[model samples]
Target chain A: MVHSIDQYVDVVGAPVVEQLRRLGERLKDIRVVHVNSTREGGGVAEILYWMVPLMNDLGLKASWEVIHGDEGFFGVTKSIHNGLQGYPVQLKKKDWDHYEEINLKNREHLLPVLEEADIVVIHDPQPAALLQMIPNRRGIWIWRAHIDVSRPHHQVWKSLKQYVQDYDASIFSLTSFAQILPHEQFIIAPSIDPLSEKNMPLNKRYVNEIAKAYNLDRSRPLIVQISRFDRFKDPLGVIEAYRITRKVIPIQLVLAGGGATDDPEGKEILDEVYKAAGDDPDIHVLLLPPDAHRQINALQRLADIVIQKSIREGFGLTVTEGLWKGKPVIGGDVGGIRLQVISHYTGYLVNSPEGAAHRIRYLLHHRAKMREMGKTAKEFARENFLLTRQIREYLTLYLYLLKDRGRSVFV
Target chain B: MDMDTVPFYIKDCTLLIKMSGFSPAFDIRDLRERIAQCSPSVIYHHYFENLLAPTFDYPDFRNDFAVWVKRQLDDDVLAERLGMIEPYRFDSLEDLRTHTLDIIDERLSELHFITAVPPGHEFYFQEAITVVFETGHVMNNPGEMFKIMPQLTSSSIYYHFLEARRRTPDLTDDFSLWLENFGSEWEPLIRDLRSIDFIFYSLPELKEELLYIMQQYEVKE
Candidate 1:
C-alpha cells in the first residue's frame, strides 16, 4: 500500500484521518474488487491508481481489475458514453453484438477472481454486463456509473439499463444524474487524491522547470484546463472563451489533456481541436501522454486560473485538483461542476463563451479578489473532496450493503 | 391633390385578415375595415403561412416571425419589432389575436398598406391551421417541451411498467415493442405540431388517443 492514508494528515488533518481509520476497521479483511475498463488515463483509472492501495492500507483486501477489449469494442462503448452524456447516437444491433462479445470474453478470464470476491464494484457501462455473465456469483454487485445520465438517449439507455438496473445497488456522481432503477441508487461524488503526484505540493524550481519545458511564460497570466479530449469536455468552447477574453486581457490559454486507452474518440477530437486552434501561438494545445503526471501537476500549479468548461461533466476531478492547488475554477454550469463551483464564491459558473470570457476578465483584473477566491476554493476541497472523506463513505456503504441484502439501501 | 382622394396604390390588390372567434361586434373590425381600404397587395394570413406554420408552436416563434417581417419590409423596423412580441404569453388565444390585430392597426395607420397574402390561398395552410388548438398549456417549442415534460414518460411505457419488470425480463408480450415502434413512427407527426405548430385540447381528431394516454399515465398539466 503506497498511499498509507496517514500521509493525508498534514493536508486534511489527523482527526479526519482517524475518523476514516475508525470506519475502515469495521470492514477489515473484506475482499473488494474494483472492475473498470482501463488502468491508465481518465479520471476513474487515476482515482483507483491510488484508491486501491489506500484501501489496502486501511486493512481491507482491495484489488483492481482491468478489462481488455479491442478497438471495435471500444468504439461501441464510446457511443454508449456519448449517449449517456445526452448526445443522441443510434446504436444498432451489430454494436450490441460487439459489446457483448467483448464482455463475454472478459467474463471467462474474470470469473475465477470475481467468484471469490466479497464485493464487486463495476465502474461505468464498459463492464456493467459482467455481473450477469459471472454465473452463480456469490458477492454483492454494485454498478457505479461515473457519467451524467440525466437525459440519456432513450434508445441507448434502454440497451444499457437492461444490464445494470438489476444490480444490488447503483452509484452515480450526482443525484441529478441518477436514473430510475429498481435497485438502490447512491449519489457519491468522485474525489481527488491530494497526496498524489498530480496534485501534491511542489517547490518553485521543479514547477518552473516543468513550465519552461512546456514553453509557458511565468510572467504572463495563464489559464489551464486539464481533461480528456472528449466532445463532452468542450475543448473548442474553451478556445472560443480564450479568444473573447484575449480581446481585453492579454492572457495565454493551455488546453492540456491525454487520451484513455479504452476511449476511441480521443484522436478525432484532438484533430478537431488542432483545426480550431489555427495559428494562435498564445493558445497552447498540448496532447500529453497518460503518464505525464508531473507535467500536469506543474502546469496546474503555475497557472493563474483554472478552467474546466465542460458542456457535460461527471464530477470533474480536474476541478477538484485545481481547487486543492488553491486556484479558483471557472467551470461550465453543467453536471457535477455545479456541485463544486459556487458561482462567485469558489469561482464562476458560465453557460457560454461570452459568460466565461466575462468572468475570466473580471478575475484577472481583481488580483486580491482572485486570491481570496482561491483560498476559499482550497478550503472547500479540503472539507468535501478529499480521498479520506470518499473512502469513509464507501466503507459506510459497504457495511450497509453487508447488513441489508434488500434493494432498500440508499444515500 | 384633394384631401379625400384615395391613393392609386389602393387599387393594387385586396388585403384580407382571417381569424376565428372574430366578429363585427368586436372593436377589431375598425382596424379590419381600415386594412381593407388600403387595397394592399398582400394578405396577412396567406403571406405569412410558411412562416406561421413552422413557428406557431415553436418557442422561437416570436424571433422567427420578426426575421420574416424584417426581410419582407426591410425599411420598416417598427413592423419588425411588432412581429417579435411573444403573443402566446397572453391570457388566451383571443387575447393574442386581439394583440396581433392592434399591431396590424398600428402598421396600417403608418404605412398605408398591409403585408399579408389573402387567406385560403396557401397549399397546406388549412392542414397546418387545423392542427393548432386554442386551449391547454402550450408546449410552444421542442426545447421547452423537453424541458417541462417528464422525458421518461413522454414517449416510452418503460417507466409505467417499471415495477412489473423488476425481477426478470419483462417481455410481457409485444406491448413495449409495439409502443417503441409507435413512438418512433409518431415522433415526426407530433413533433411538427408540438414544436413548430400549436397543439391544444381542441385538436380532438389527432389528440383523442393522446389524451387517453395522458389520463392513463396521470400526466397533470
Candidate 2:
C-alpha cells in the first residue's frame, strides 16, 4: 500500500479547496471506496493514492483498495490493455478463464466491502470483471477508464465487453474513448497535481542535489524524458533523437521510470534501451523506484528540454507533469497526448525521432521560444490538467446520478 | 404528507440547481425514495413511474422530478429535507470510531422507539414487486435505478454512466438476440430494489400525454 500523504494537496489549488469544503459540508460521513490494479507504477494508482486521502480530508469517508492479479492474469490483462490501445494480440479461451478466475477470486474476498460501501468504484480492465460476480452488492459501481480508446483493436474490445457490460457505468478520459455500453458514460479527463513533487516548483538546490547524486552535470544542457521503459513509449526512439541532437550540441538525456505490475514488457524494453545507450556517457538510463516523485520533479525543473515520444498513450501524466513544471515537452501525436501537447503551443507532437530531434535542436538553440512555449504549456495545464476541475465534474456527475435515480419514467 | 400531494411543483419554470449552491442540507437525490427513507424503495411503487423507464424520453423529467424533490429539503428557503440532522460529529477518520460510539451512546440515552414504516404499508411494497413479476417485463427498464442496481441516485456518476449506455448506440446485434436475452443478469439488482416480499402494485401513470416523446429518441437496451 502506497502511503496516503499530502504530497499532491497544494496543486489542488484554492478553487478545489473551496469546492471541497462545501462538498464536505453537504457530504458528511458518506463512504467512498476506490478499487484499482497495482498500488504503484500506473497513473491511476498514483492519482488515487493521493486523491482518496484528499477526498477523505475534505470530509468524506474515502479509502483505496488494490486488486490482486497474478502473472498469467496480468499477461491476459496486458493483452486487453494492448488491444484497447489498438493492438491486435490473439489469446486462447483459457486466457480469459484465468482473467475471470482472478476476478472471481477477488469478488469472493471483496463481497463484504462491495456490499457495504456507499459507492464501490472499479478502475480499469484487470478488476472490471469483479462486477459480474458481485452477489448482493448494493452500492454504485463506476468504471473509471483512464485509457485513450479512440482507436481500440476489435477482438480485445469484444472480449472485454462481456465484463464491462456489467458495470453501472463507465467513464472515459475523452469522448472519443467511449464505447457502446449498457450504462451511463461520462467524459472526465484525467489530471495531474500542480503541487505534487512531480509538478511543483522545487528549489534550485534540490534539483542540483539530485543531479549531483545521479552524476548528472548541472552545467550541461539536459534533455530528459521520464516514462516507463516500454516499447510503446518509444524509449529507443528517444535515444535516437538524443543521439541526433547530440551531433551538434552535446546534451545529456535521462530516461527514467519503473515497470507497472501489469506491464510485462517493461523490463525487456529497459534492457533494449540500455543497449541503444551503450557507452554513451551523455545518456543516463535510470530505472527509478515508483516513489521517486520529487526526483522526477527536480529532473523536469533542471532539464532544458523534455520528450515523451510514445507510440500510444493514455493521457500521459508525465507530459502533464513536465508541462506543469514549465518545460516544453515533445510527445507522440496520439491518444490523450494530443489533448495535452498542442503542437508548437504547449509542446511539439512528433511522429518520429527525426521530428523529435529537429524540435529538440530548435528549442535548444532558441531559449526564448522554449521559454514562451513552456509558459503556454504550464498555463494550458493550469486551465485544463488540474485535479480540482476533475473533482468538480465528478461531484456534478454524482448529483446528476442521484436526481435521475427516482425520476418518473417517460413512458 | 399525503402521498398524492404535489408538494413543490414549479408549474412554469425549471430549476436544475446543485444542492451545495441551493439546499446544502438535502442529499440531492433524484429518487425521492433514496433520500426520504432508509428503505425508500419501500415505496418502490412510488418510483415505478418516477424512477424506471428511459430518462431521455422525458424532456421535463428533471423539472417534473424536481417538483417532487425540491420539497424534500428543509433549507427553509427551499423544499422538504428529510432524515435527522442532529447526529454525532465524526469530522475525520482519526475520530470516526470514537465519534460513532458517542452516537451509539447518545442514541441509547435518547431512545424513542417509533416504527418508521407505517401499519399495513408492507402490503403496498409487496404489491410493487409484481409489476415485473415475469422476467420479460423488467428488461424494458434497462438502466433505470430500480432495474440497474440498488443504492444509486440519478445524479451519481454510476447512474449517469448507465444513462449513457441507455442512450442510443448503433448496435451490431439483432432484435431477436436482445429480446431472447432476458437480462436475468440484472435480476439481483432489480430484486434488491423491489422488496423481496414485494406485492404486485402498479403505480399510476401520470404523463400519458407526454409518453409519445420517448419514441422520438432511440435509447439502447
Q: Against the true two-chain complex, what DockQ does each candidate achieve?
A: 0.01, 0.01
Q: On residues B1-221, what C-alpha lDDT tens digit does candidate 1 reach at each position?
A: 33222121100000111121111111223435533432211222322222222110212223323433443334255545555665334443345455656776666567755444222111111111111111122333323333323321211121122111222343221123222333354354343333322222111122334344434333332
User: Which pairs of residues clash in candidate 1, taking residues 3 or more apart in a chain or in different chains?
Assistant: B42-B116, B43-B116, B43-B117, B44-B116, B47-B117
Q: Which ten contiguous residues of candidate 1 chain A have the minimum total lDDT?
A: A402-411
Looking at candidate 2, what is the lDDT of residue B79?
19
Q: Write the per-residue lDDT of candidate 1 for residues A324-351, one digit (tens) a residue.
A: 8888899998888877887677888898
- TM-scores, all models, native as reference: 0.64, 0.63
Best by TM-score: 1
Model 2: CA > 4 A from native: A1-15, A405-411, B1-221
Candidate of highest lDDT: 1
